[model samples]
Target: MGSDALSPEVAARERTLDDLRRRMASVPGRGESATGHIPREQPLRRDLLPVPGPLAELLPDGGLPKGAVVAYSGAHSMLSGLLAAVTGDGGHAAVVGLPRLGLLAAAEMGAQLSRLAVIADPGPDPAEVAAVLLDGLDLVVLGLGDLAVPPARCRVLAARARNRGATLVVAGGTWTNPSLRLDTRVTGYRGLGAGRGRLRSVCLDVRVSAKAGPPRHGRIDLCAQAGRTEWLAREAETREVVDLREAVS
Candidate 1:
């Protein structure tokens, strides 16, 4: 029977049932309905950003912790590889003031160009530009480029990121108090010989030192070969990475 034709008491009961159903559907993580999902606004816990399996160990939390600032110095290829996990999985990423950024290489590393933005140069006040992007971007990659960011400004950005659950990654430089710092050095290059072949891959020796965690060191591979595999793998097959991490720690 139509709701208009029902008795008042029966109609009230039906309305209550409908209201209960709506409340149940809106309960986050319970289940989704056809209309749309009602997200949890006040969850006690938050989740980290997705990271590639091989690079997961680099982060203390096994994933890129939201609201953390990481500094990547002299690790262009590694930065690109890391960004691929974010941009490829429908996350928005921004690159500012890194004119020499290998965009083609970033794609080869698996980043979805459609979801990435590159400012190349942001004029004199790049930090100000970054502040604006922090409002909406999932990740903001800023190029240091000799511009010195004051301590107070850095703190403000860090606080903002924490509040917004976004990551602030500074590349090609360092900051006053970065949550993590990685120094990358090219230990060797492979798949090339005597000025006769193209560069295929690089072996990087990275020393990971963090302000909030213990220090560790490891080797990571950045390969441009066809069907590239894990970018970070242990040099010794017999020794596990976790064991090496413990040894280094």
Candidate 2:
């Protein structure tokens, strides 16, 4: 629905209500009402907003699978903290060789600053950073950059995560390293016309496949600037479906 459909007064009122609901959801230590009869105020946990329909069913936790690697290309900035969000609250995470990301933005995305560690400015070989990641973290985020890491290293990293129950996220660089993979691409929808204000949105198309699990695929609309990441059912035609042949082999 267009924002113009409602009168300015109504729109203002709706926005106020939205803000109040969001604030109430954010209150700390505010559990169910003292009587214990009130329905729990939105299950208390720090999960990612929600998963897209098709992919959600495939995940055991209705989110990204724990202790597995999910990859993204050209949209790292857009889908930051994917691992941490999927890992839930109080989860530990590490970022390797991510030289360009804004640390504050990282914090905003969900990785706790106290729980996060960074391996900055590493050499071209990603294996070096991968080794530290495999040994240290419960969840690891890595940027490929110029590194041409061997396929064997990716396999080993995935195995270590599986063995230790960690989640590995790869973004903005090389892919094609493991038995399972998730490839993502972002498409931006532009707002049109002169009378209406410009409204923009990004759709993240995800293709996820695992050796034993079903080859699942879907697209989720994500709000980048807004703190909330909600699932969008209807949208423009910019989303794309990726073929898994290359990733599976």
Candidate 3:
């Protein structure tokens, strides 16, 4: 197999192999092989994003995992809070097909307005929009509105999220095989007494359940002031009950 005696085809194959090795060696990493496909740690190194104070306790790591597929119903404010939590960290968030989603409310709750995108009323279909957003954003909230999204569509979006390492949050519709399921309702209100008082806190009955765990219910009081939001703890027994009633005029 001397080079001088090698056939033309054999010599060409050798040249191609050498070129491939050279290219692989030029790539960065701590691997031994020339093209050691690099360790899985590179992508997994992205740390999980922290959730809002009120909902942090509900998640397993007290933070949202990348590539998570979540389905939520009930209180719209809760959905907005989750968006703010992700967008607060400089991560981009896309709200697809939600014509009535309150952008100002999310802004007041800590979301960076610059990182938020609203694709309201996304034509007759939003699956394409969601897919495209998933490729570029860290968080994509797909609003199915009153229409029931098909299982196939959910699976497709879920696959896309997994491939892109983006969190997929579904609202106004149901989904199958969701990594997390959230049910929230406005059970009461706080920081107001009469119909003329200023609005303060909103009491939410949040039920959180994951694919591997049982459902858990808890009460959370969220207060927004001066365009900022925080979780409000209940008063002690000795203190007078500051009734959390809604302010209406």
Candidate 4:
């Protein structure tokens, strides 16, 4: 049963799988026991993956649920935050089909780039690549682009993630019945003075919807200053207005 005796197509598939395993093994903090082979009855706390500070407060599970599919919409900053949170917490992650993803922003957000694998162009079927990555990575972010994945395929990918004890995050296109959904919108920007001052922060209105229960909503602020990105609490609606004449006096 040597590989030399197998057909060309079979050999190629085997080689591809081997390469994937090698790459997965090379990721930092990927020990033998952490390669999605833990027993279901184990007492390990693998139920959820860590999310950013503000986002964790919004989720019912306090983090992204393992073995589930989550659909995200709106700003790409949210996706960067997810990647930064997961990878920064010593978990391996993969990004597929997000060619324009800002790695610098993720780094500023505290992501460990060494533990992240980015597949900017995942061939014709990015879903297939994501499915494969779920076998090893703790989180897989799949950019659907313009492809409308069929319901059956979506179900299959979700099942694969569940069986592998990984999380799949889908962006763009349409996903059928995701376990959770996050929608974010930029409400406003801070540090502007009559369109003359540099931007200092962004305000995001985030909504979290689950398969059951009422949806939760929150506002978050992303402050970029001093070469770091900080997630701050929601700003208050009421603020003290200072008159220009009084301030000048």
What is the C-alpha lDDT profile of model 1 across 1-249, one tens digit per residue?
Answer: 775698876666556545534543432231112234432242212456656565667667666667888887885777777678677655667787787888887888788786677778666666766666666666788898877788998999999988877788888644789888867776666545545356556677777777766777777777666754347564666322222233234
Q: Model 2 off-target regions past 4 Å?
A: 1-61, 77-79, 83-88, 102-106, 172-179, 190-200, 212-214, 224-249
**Largest lDDT belongs to which candidate?**
4
Q: Is candidate 1 or candidate 4 better by lDDT?
A: 4
Candidate order (lDDT): 4, 3, 1, 2
TM-scores for every candidate against the unseen true structure: 0.72, 0.58, 0.74, 0.81
Candidate 2: lDDT over CA atoms? Answer: 0.53
Question: lDDT tens digits, residues 1-249, model 3?
Answer: 665797776656456445534543443332112244432233223646546775777676676677888888888787788788766655667788887878888878887776677777665556666777676677888888777778898788888888877888888766778888888888666556645366677777788888786787767877877767776543434232244442342
Quote model 2's TM-score: 0.58
Q: What ranking emerges by TM-score with the best candidate at the front?
A: 4, 3, 1, 2
Candidate number with greatest TM-score:
4
What lDDT score goes with residue 34 in model 4?
Answer: 41
lDDT of 2 by residue, 41-125 (tens): 3332233223344446444456655466766555554445453343234444556677676666555556456555665654455
- Ten-residue segment with the worst summed lDDT in candidate 2? 27-36
* Collision pairs in model 1: none
Superposed on all Cα atoms, the candidates' RMSDs to the truth, in angstroms, are: 15.9, 17.8, 13.7, 6.8
Candidate 1 vs candidate 4, TM-score winner: 4
Backbone clash pairs for candidate 2 read none
Backbone clashes in candidate 3 total: 2
Candidate 2, residue 111: how far the Cα is off, in Å? 4.0
